[model samples]
Target: MKRDSCQQRIYAVRRVGLAIDRAARATSKIDKRQAARWATAWGVACGVRQF
Candidate 1:
């Protein structure tokens, strides 16, 4: 597979993962936006890349 196409697939997967995380947080009675912020901060602190 081409590098560009592989990158696009990785990006799409990250977006979907983030969406699922937010949805799960919402169902748990947490504020979605706040949950997203927390997730991003945690990712950054853990040296993980964010999309």
Candidate 2:
């Protein structure tokens, strides 16, 4: 039981890490429109107006 729980935890962590890695890789390939949207959201969150 303990070993099974440990294995499950490791699997979950690996899945989350892989998702983060994919997101980082995808962000690097973002086009201007997506980048603009991200920038706008970030600016709004930071209380700045993004043109």
Candidate 3:
């Protein structure tokens, strides 16, 4: 008789929501977008799995 092993995979999700004050937060919006872009780029460069 033989035994087999299996691997499990997990994923992380980020949910961004919009608000009514969105019209007054231009700088904040830009900053958030820049951060997200950098993070994804860095992850890809480092071979990080993102969902």
Candidate 4:
């Protein structure tokens, strides 16, 4: 609930989201699968219960 904490969370999500996006754009199928896994981790880090 603190101001700095909220900003830090936003920054963390942005970093993870960017990595997942880059992975998603890879031409190899393996990369895409890896990206899917990263997405789950990212979701968990962002406090998403279900997606």
Which has the greatest lDDT?
4
Global CA lDDT computed for model 3: 0.39
Model 2 stretches astray by more than 4 angstroms: 1-3, 27-51
Query: What RMSD, rounded to one decimal, does every model reach?
Result: 6.9, 11.4, 10.1, 3.7
Cα misplacement distance, residue 11 of candidate 1 (Å): 0.3
lDDT of 4 at 17: 84
Q: How many pairs of residues collide in model 3?
A: 0
Q: Candidates ranked by TM-score, best first?
A: 4, 1, 2, 3
lDDT of each: 0.61, 0.51, 0.39, 0.72
Could you estimate the TM-score for every candidate? Answer: 0.46, 0.45, 0.42, 0.59
lDDT of 2 at 42: 47
Clashing residue pairs in candidate 4, if any? none
Task: Please provide, for model 3 over 1-51, each residue's C-alpha lDDT reduced to its tens digit, 9 standing for 90 to 100.
Answer: 542321111111111112212323546777667656655554443345356
Worst 10 residues of 3 by lDDT: 7-16
Task: List the candidate 1 regions with Cα displacement exceeding 4 Å.
Answer: 1-3, 27-51
User: Where does model 4 exceed 4 Å of error?
Assistant: 1-4
Compared with the true structure, what per-residue lDDT tens digits does model 2 show for residues 1-51?
355755665655555455445555564555544545554554443444435
Error of 3 at 11 (Å): 23
**Candidate 3 residue 8 C-alpha distance from true site, Å:** 27
